[model samples]
Target: MEPKAHHVVIGFFTLVAVAAALVFALWLEKSQTDTEWAYYRINFDHPVGGLAEGNAVLYSGVNVGTVEDLTLAPENPAHVRVLVRVDQNIPIRANTKAGLVLANITGSMSVQFTGGSPDSPVLNGSRENPPVIEAQPSTLTSLLSNSETLLTKADQLLGSANELLSEDNLENIARILENTRAASESLLQSREDLIALLEQFNAAGARTEDAASRVSGAANHAREVLGKLEPVIAGLADSVNSLQPTLERLDRLTADNEKALDTGLQGVGELGPALRELRNTLRTLNSFTRRLEQDTRGTLLGEETMKEYRE
Candidate 1:
């Protein structure tokens, strides 16, 4: 009897559980029916990121629908046909696009709906076609692949770098550093020569400055000399002017002296004959005087020696 009671209890509980499950299933169905829904289709030439049914359909990050079906397009085997059931009031327009999105790094993907033109009419049925967007390669996938390749290449490069930094290379580097040091020392030794050359240039510049100063001084001196000589030249001109009349008078005197000398010469020429006659008269007078002297001497008695001397 207890076993039968236990069986009965188990059967009652099983019936209640089945009834509850049916009620829950009916509630789910009614809830699904209550939602206003619409169907649309998109066609693609390739698998859209491995999109499957029940994938979320998002419009600007808002989940508005889900993918209902995926099949090969009837006309084109290469093309895939996707059916989407969205909320009825969502108002997908004719120009809307259905693109696949990678939702995660683990290759999970979703459908993104966008580009509904306001002027275009709203899509009604499955016949209303939304344009399928070609899926671009995901950045995450590309970055992951690139990271792997980069890490592999980095390892190879690191190995090569390690080989390059071997002991022989280190010694070569050391030798190069030593040579550089020697060259630097040689350059340092030449610094004094460079400084000396600069000093010489400075001295030359000073000398040039001195020469320029001397030239300026000479110019100033020349200007001063010319300034002093200007008045002297003016005085000389005045003196020359003052002496001009005297010079003219001297010239006139010289001319007059020349004329007087000429006139005197002419007078002397005119007196030549008169002077000759006078000279002859003087000679006769001298003879008369001599005779008178002789007479006187005779008269004075003792002039016979004077007469013989006269002959």
Candidate 2:
């Protein structure tokens, strides 16, 4: 009885273990079925940087699926094509862009998805017609490349520095320094003469400026005198024009008087003496007027300033 009881306990424990394994398997299958898969292609212009098959595909840091295949494009060997399996529940829209991201500096790479809008249409793809997702340059890859370029430049600079620090180059530099010192000494020796020449030039410039200023002042004064004479000349011309009627009257009077005198002289001899006296007075008056005009220079337009200059 004791042996039969032990066998029954052993058999019960074995059955329980099998039931637990079956339940775990069924749960795993249900979990896998909840996620649906879709296909897509990612085209990269840069190197994938150690990304290989079975690499994770993520959407906003969530693992969605994995890389199904990778290949270099047949038409353009420089381009890389990647086929990825993604969760169908995740909307792979037309506006979605892709990039290769390095999770760590150890070159572990993954595909990153961004910018999928709900209003966008689905990015449907198949084995023959694989929809391409655009990939940007990876930051890590760019950094690595820049670092390599910087190192190369640094190496070149070090080589040049080493060459420049050699014995022959140092001797050449020393010669150049000595020549510069000699030139400086020569310049110092001629410094006094240079200063004197500059001082003389400055003095000449100052004298020239002063002369030009004096000339300018003289020109201004002349211009002012001309301006003042302009009105005087105009008034004198007007005075001469005003004398036209008087001259005409005087000519008529002279013609009449000459005729009358000629007639009277024939009749009376005493009339000749009186006529001569009148002629003498007229000549004296004409002479006095001509002298006055010639002396005053026709400037006495009004009597207000006449006494000031005429006196």
lDDT of each: 0.80, 0.87
Among residues 3 or more apart in sequence or in different chains, the pairs in candidate 2 whose N, CA or C atoms overlap within 3 Å are none
lDDT by residue (tens digit), candidate 2, 52-86? 89989999888998888999999988889999988
Off by over 4 Å in 2: 1-30, 126-129, 144-150, 164-311
Error of 1 at 72 (Å): 3.7
lDDT of 2 at 83: 94
Using Cα atoms with residue i matched to residue i, what is each candidate's TM-score against the true structure? 0.40, 0.46
Q: Could you say which candidate leads in TM-score?
A: 2
At residue 133, candidate 1 shows an lDDT of 39
Q: Candidate 1: lDDT of 112?
A: 73
Instruction: Give the per-residue lDDT digits (tens) of candidate 1, residues 106-163.
Output: 6666777777888998768743564343433445435554787889999999999999
Q: Locate the minimum summed-lDDT window of 10 residues in model 2.
A: 298-307
Task: Report clash pairs, candidate 1.
Answer: none
Shift of residue 162 alpha carbon in model 2, Å: 2.8
